[model samples]
Target: MRVVVLGGAGFLGSHLCGTLLAAGDEVVCIDNLSTGRRTNTTPFLGRPGFEFVHADIAAGPLCVRGAVDAVANLASPASPPDYHRMPLETLAAGSRGTEHALQLAAQHGARFLLASTSEVYGDPDVHPQPEDYWGNVNSVGPRSVYDEAKRYAEAVTMAYRRQFGDDVGIVRIFNTYGPGMRPEDGRVVTSFITQALNGDPLTIYGDGSQTRSFCYVDDLVRGLVAMLTSTETGPLNLGNPVEWTVLELARIVLEVTGSTSPLEFHPLPQDDPTRRRPDIGRARRLLGWQPEISAHEGLRRTVEWFRARPAEVAAAAPSVAGPQVEPRPGARIPSPRRSAPVLS
Candidate 1:
C-alpha cells in the first residue's frame, strides 16, 4: 500500500510513518516544518520505503506523482503552544490542508483518514464524551482556533464523503504521549515529564481538578492503521477510556521520574475543558482496538527516552501560559491552566 501522511514530520506523524514503513508500505511524507521538527524524520530519510516532502498543503498546491492508496491527514498544530502560536496555520491545516488531502484521495480513489481531536468536544459538558456529543465550545475564545479548526475539519471530511463519495474516516484522538514528543510542546505530559526530569517546579493550573485520558502513541497508531485498512467510515473515538486527574498525573510523573519538584499552582485559562475522556466502544467493536499501555508504563518508557535526551529535556523549562486568578473571596479557587491541554 502507498500512504501519504500529511504533517509526517511531527511527533505522532513521525511515529505513524515508521509503523507504516515497518509494515512494508510505501510512504510519501509531507510537512513544512512549521511546528514539526525535521529531526523527527531523520531516521527515515534514507529508508527505501520512505520519502519525505518539504511542503505545506495549506500554503499551496500538493503535487504527489504516483498511485496513492491512503491519505492520513494529521497536518495541524496539535499542541497548545503550537496552535496558540500559529492560530492561522492551525485553522488552515484543519480546513484547507484537510481539503487538499481529501482532494488527493478523491483524485486517486483512495481512502482518506482524518485525524480529528477531542478538542471538538470543547470543555465538554458531557463526561466521558461519546462520538455523538456536539461539544460545548466557545467559537470566539482563544482556544477556539484549534477547537473550531477540528470541528471544521470533521465537517468538511463528512461533506466530502457525502457529496463526492470519498472514502474517508474520522478519529477523535485523545491525549497521546510517548517518545519523540518535543519537550517544549507545552502539553501536560511533556511539560510535567520535562519539568520532573529537570527538577523544576511542576506547574498545575485550575487547582488541578481537570481530568484527561492519555493514550499511548503506539496504541493510537495501531488504531489508525486498522481504520486505514478497513472500510469503516466512522468518527470513532480512538483513545484510552481510563481517566486521570491533572493532579494525579502530576504526582505519578514525580514518582516515575523520582523527582522532588514541588507543584506550583496558577490561574486557569478561559474555555479550559473541565473534563475529557473518550468512549472508544465503537473502535473496539469496529476495529478490534483498545489502548494496551498503562499510563505508568508509558510514562516510564517516555521518561526513559527523555532521560537519554538530557539536553532537550533540560532546555524545556515549564511555563504556565495564562491569566492569574485570586481566590474567589476566600473560596480559594486555586487552579492553573488545565492539567495541560489534552491535545496530542
Candidate 2:
C-alpha cells in the first residue's frame, strides 16, 4: 500500500514509517523539524519505498504525487515540553494540520487515520478509560493547546466521515515509550531516564502516586497498522492496560539504568491525571490487538538506546531538573505547571 505519514519524522511517527516500509509498503514521510528530529528519518533517507518531505501540513496544503492508499496523521509536538514550548503551533497542528491530512485522504479516496491521545480524558473520573467515555478536558488550561487540539481533531475527523463520506479511523494512544524518544522531551519516561543516566535528581512533580499505563512503541505501531488496515471507524484505545504509579515507574527506571539518582518530591502539576489506564476491550475485539511487550523489556531497549547517546542524555539533564513547585504545609499538591495532552 502507498501511505502518506504526516509528521513522519517524530518518535512515534518515525517508528510507524519504518514499520510500514518493512512491510513492503510505499511511504511518503512529511515533517517540519519544529519538534520532530530529522535523524529519526535519516536511516530511511535512501531506503526503497521511502520518501521524506520537509514541510508542515499546518503551515500549508500537502502535495503528494501518484495514488495514495492511506494517510496516517501523526503530526504534532507530542511531548509535554514541546507542546508547552509551542502552544500555538501545537494547537494549529491538531486543528489545521489534521484537516489537511483528512482533506488529502478524502481527495485520494484513501483511509484516514487520526492519532489522538489519552490526554483528551483529562483527570479522568473513570477508572479504566474506555472509548465511550467522554473526556474531562480543560479547554482553557495550559495543556488545552494540545488536549483541545486532539479533541478537535477527533471531532473534525467524525465530521469528515459524516459530511464528506470520508473513510477514517481514530486511535486514542496512551503513554508509549521506547527508542527514538528525545531525551529532553519532558515526558515521565524520558525525564527519568535522562536524569538517572546523568546522575541527577529524578523530579517527581507530584508526590508520585499518579498512575499511567506505558505501551511499548513496537506494540503501539502494530496496533496503529492494524487500525489502518481495518475498516473500524473507531476511537479505539491503543495502549497497555497494565497500570503503574509514578513512584513505581521512577524506581523501575533507576533500577533499569542502575543509577543512584535521588528522588525529589514536589507538588503535582495541575491537570495531571491522578490515574490513567486504557480499556482496550474494543481494540481487542475489533482490531485483535493488544500490547505484548512488558514495560521492563521496553525500558531495557530504550535505556540502551539512550545510553549510546551520552551527549544528548547529558545535555537533557539540566532541563529535566527544572524549578520545583513546593507544596506548603497541609496544602493540596496541585501545581501550576502545564501538561501537554497528557503529563506524568
Candidate 3:
C-alpha cells in the first residue's frame, strides 16, 4: 500500500515510517521540521520505496504526485513544551492541517487516520479514560491551545466521516517514548533519561505523585498500523494500561541509567493532569493490540541510546537561548541499535 504520513520526521513519525517501510509499503513522508528534526529521518533518505517532502500541512495543501492509499495525519507540536512554545502553530496544525489532510484523503478515497492525543481528556474526572468519556478540559487554560485543538480535530474528523462518508479513524495516543525522542523534548521520559545520563538532578513536580501510562514507540506504531488497515472507524484509545506514579518513573529512570542523580521537587504546571491512563479496551478487542515493552526495559534501551551519543543529546538540551550548543568536533557517531522486545 502507498501511504502518506504527515510529520514523518518526528520522533513517533520516524518510527512509523521505518515500520511501514519494513512491511514493504510505499511511504511518502512530509514534514516542516518546526519541531521535528531532519536527523530523525536521515536513515530513510534515498531509500527504496520511501519519499520525503518538506512541507507544512498547516501552511497549504499537501500535493503528492502518485496515488495515496492511506493518509496518516500525525502533524502537530505534540510535546507540552513544544506546543506551549508554538501555541499558534499547534492550533493551526490541528485545525488547518487536519482539514487539509482530510480533504486530500477524501479526494483520493483513501483511509484517513488522525493521531489525536490523551490530553483531550484534560485533568479528567474519570480515571483510566475511555474513548466515550467527555473530557473535563478548561478551554481558557494555558494548555487549552493543544487540548481544544485536538478536540476540534476529532470533531472535524467525525463531521467529515458523517457528511462525506470518508473512511477516517481517530487514535488517542498516550505518552509514548523511545530512542528517536529528542533528549530535550521536555516530555517526562526524555527529561528524566537525559538528566539521569548527565548526572543532573531529576526534576519532579507537585511532590511527584502524578501518574502516567507510557507505551513504547514500536508497540504504539504497531497499533497505529493496525488501526490504519482495520475496518473500525473509531476514536480508539491506544496506550499501555500499566500505570506508574511520577516518583516511581523517576526511580526507574535512575535505575536504568545507573545514575545517582538526586530528585528535585517543583510546582506543577497549570492544568497538568494529576493522573493519566487509557482504557484501551477497544484497541484490544478490535485491533488485538497491547504494548509489549515494560517500562524498565524501555528506559534501559533509551539510556543506552543517549549514552552512545552524549554529545548529540547534550547539544539538543533545552536552555534559555535554545538548542544552540555545538557538539565536539570528533564525537563518535553511534550505529543504530534496535530495541529489544520484552520476553514473557
Candidate 4:
C-alpha cells in the first residue's frame, strides 16, 4: 500500500507514518511544520519506504505522483490552545485541507480516513456520546473555531461519500494519550505530566467533576488502520469506554510521576464539556476495537516519554512562576498563552 499522511510530522501523524512503514506500506508524509516538528519524523527520513514533503495543506492540492492506496487526513490544530490560537488556519485545514485529501483519494482510487474528534459532539448532552447524536454545540462560542470547523469537515467528508460514492472513513477520536503526544500540546495528559515533572501544582477546572475518556495512541492507531482497511465507512466513535473524572486523572498523574504537587483549580472555560465518553459500540461491532490500555499504564508510558525527551518537554512546557492561588480543585486549567500575537 502507498499511504499519504497529511500533517505527517505531527505527533499523531508521525506515529502513524512509523506504523504504516512498519506494516510494509510505502509512506509519503506531507506537513507544513507549523505545529508539527521535523524531528518527530527524522528517524524515518532515510527509510527506503518513507518520503517526506514540507508543504502547507492549504496551499492547494498535494502533489503526489502515481496512485495512492490510502489517504489519512490527520492535519488540524487538535488541542484547544492550538485551535483557539490559529482559528482560521484550523478552519482552512479542516475545510480545504480535508477537500484536498479527498480529491487526492478520489484521483488515486484510494481509501480516505479522516481523524475527526469528539469535539464535534460539542458539550454533548448525552452521557455516553453515540455516532447518531446530532450534538449540542455553540457556533459562536470561543471553542467554535475548532468544533464548527470539524463539524464542517465531517460534513464535507460525508458530502464526498454521498455525492461521489467515495470510500470515506471518519473516526471521531476521543482523548488519546501516549508516547508521541507533544509534551507542550496543552492536552490534559501532557499538561499534567509536565506539571508533575516540574513539581508544580496540577490544575483543574469547574469543581474537578468533568469527565473524559482517553484512548491510548497505539490502540487508536490500530483502530485507524482497521477503519482504513474495512469496508465500513464510518463517523464511528473510536476511544476507550473507560471514563475518569478530571480529579481522578490528576491524581493518577501525580501518583505516576511521584510529584508532590498540590491541586489547583479555576473556573471552567466557555463551552468546555462536563463529560465526554465515547460510546464505542459501533467501533466494537465494525472494527473489533476497544481500548486495551488503562489510564495508569497510559500515563506511565507518557511520563516515560516526557522524561526521555527532557529537552523537548522543557521547550514545550509552560514557564513556572507565581505562588499557587486559592486552590480551585476541579477547574479547567487556563489555555497556554499564545506565543505570537494572533491577527484577527
* Model number with the top TM-score: 1
lDDT of 2 at 56: 69
Question: What's the residue-level lDDT of 62 in candidate 2?
Answer: 65
Candidate 4 C-alpha lDDT tens digits along 1-344: 99989988988899899999998998888887878889989889899989888777765766688668999999998887777657678888898788888888898888999999999999999879999998999998878878888899899999999999999999999998888777777888888888888877777877889999888899898898899888788899999999999999998888999999998887787778999999999999989988887888888888988899878766765623222333445645434322311111
Residues 105-186, model 1: lDDT tens digits:
8878999999999999998888889999899989988888899999999999999989988899999999999999999989
Q: Write the per-residue lDDT of candidate 3 for residues 1-344, one digit (tens) a residue.
A: 99999999999899999999999998988888988999988898898988888777877665676688999999999988787677777888899889988988887899999999999899999999999999999898878889999999999999999999999999999999999888888888988888787778888877989999999888999999999999788899999899999999999888878889999887788788998999999999999999999988887887888889889766655322221124536644433223211111
Cα lDDT listed for each candidate: 0.87, 0.88, 0.86, 0.84
Assess the local accuracy of residue 223 in candidate 4 as a C-alpha lDDT between 0 and 100. 91
Clashing pairs in 4: 204-331, 204-332, 205-330, 205-331, 205-332, 206-330, 206-331, 208-330, 265-328
Give all candidate RMSDs, comma-separated.
7.9, 7.2, 8.8, 6.9
Best candidate, lDDT = 2
Query: lDDT of candidate 4 vs native?
Result: 0.84
Compute each candidate's TM-score over C-alphas. 0.93, 0.92, 0.92, 0.91
Model 1 TM-score, 2 decimals: 0.93
* Candidate 2 residue lDDT tens string, 160-270: 999988999999999999999999888999999999999999888778988999999999999999999999999999999999999999999999999999999877666
Give each model's clash number. 8, 0, 0, 9
Put the candidates in lDDT order, highest first: 2, 1, 3, 4
| Winner of 3 and 4 under TM-score | 3
Question: What is the RMSD, in Å, between candidate 4 and the native fold over all Cα?
Answer: 6.9
Looking at candidate 2, the ten consecutive residues that score lowest on lDDT are: 335-344
